[model samples]
Target: MPANFTIVTLGVADLDRSARFYRDLGWEQRGDQAEGITWFRTSGSWVGLYGYDALAEDAATEPVPADELPTYRGVTLALNLASEAAVDLAFARVQEVGGTIVKPAARTDWGGYSGYFADPDGHLWEIAHNPYWTVVDGRVDIGAT
Candidate 1:
């Protein structure tokens, strides 16, 4: 069997609020889905927001108590932009939508510009513009390993 990546589901403390955050970020939600789960179509895949407890139960895993979780979850989602200005604009928009700016957009050592922000759920998202990368149809290609 071949493995294929499809959806990235975020287990959010408040599904509606998380959905709203994404919506405010200009993401359009997909209709015709179940009311219990909200789905958004991305360039190549889908992003889903579901209730944390419901997601845990669906995955057959135990939900970690809030206090037991660390401030950094050690995972980050990235959005690669076309220009440095776009990166800055994106970071600002994130802040406008109530996301915490972890780092301001600036030139990077790798000859690119990037910044970080944390969504309402503290999921880190990196907005970057890599000179060596090629973006097409909203997907990024880092070029040959």
Candidate 2:
């Protein structure tokens, strides 16, 4: 089977805020954008942010209540960096951009360096640098052998 990921759409309580957050992180918008949706071109795949209600409606699911305080629910979006130094740099950017650090960057018992942060919507993001992994053209192979 072909291995590819074309897009990652994040359900955001406030699409504008989420889009601004990623834009602050240096992502470039691609094509035309709408009020309840914003699309950005990342290094490889497209990262998208959509209004929670819009996303839920599109999927034919109920939108999680915006004021209800959602939990991580074991979902984490990961950004794999090129090296330990890159990991630190990215995490630093997260903090500088007003993201709360959920975990400090450090060596893991699993033989990698990683950390976590929460975006404006409380969505968890894991930034990691696995020495056993390699990235080609900005896409990292998490299962490198």
Candidate 3:
């Protein structure tokens, strides 16, 4: 099988709260799925939200206590934008929707603009715009000069 990722499941403490957070960010939820789970169809993939314990049980693993998780979980989701202005706008929107800003948007050493934020469940999301990259139909394409 091809190594294609189709879904991203976020184990949330409160499904309703997490769902609301995403909704407040202007994301529409897909309600046709089974109960006890929430889904959102993104440009290219799907994002899901489920109860932390339930998700752990579904995965046949123990859920780590929230406190036991490190400040930096070492994984981040990204939203690629077309320009620095768009990146700044997205960063502001994230803050407006209750996301905690980890880093305010600014010019990066790689000649791009980017910032980071954490959702209600502390999932890190980086909003960035790389001059050499293009996002088409939610897929990123790196164009070389």
Clashes of each: 0, 0, 0
- For candidate 3, the lDDT comes to 0.87
lDDT of candidate model 2 versus the reference: 0.83
> What is the per-residue lDDT of model 1 for residues 50-87, given as tens digits with 9 covering 90 to 100?
87888999999999975576657888888998889888
Query: By descending lDDT, how would the candidates be arranged?
Result: 3, 1, 2
lDDT by residue (62-133, candidate 2, tens digit) is 876877855566788888888999899998888888888999899999999999999888888899988988
Q: What TM-score does prediction 1 earn? A: 0.91
Error of 2 at 132 (Å): 0.4
User: Which sections of candidate 2 miss by over 4 Å?
Assistant: 1-3, 142-145
What C-alpha lDDT values do all the predictions have? Answer: 0.86, 0.83, 0.87
Which structure is stronger by TM-score: 1 or 2? Answer: 1
Model 3 residue 59 distance off true place after TM-score fit, in angstroms: 1.4
- The most accurate candidate by lDDT is 3
Better of 1 and 2 by lDDT: 1
Which residue pairs clash within candidate 2?
Answer: none
Span of ten consecutive residues with least summed lDDT in model 3: 25-34
Per-prediction TM-score: 0.91, 0.88, 0.92
Task: Give candidate 3's TM-score.
Answer: 0.92
Q: Model 1, 36: alpha-carbon shift in Å?
A: 1.3
- TM-score: which is higher, 1 or 3? 3
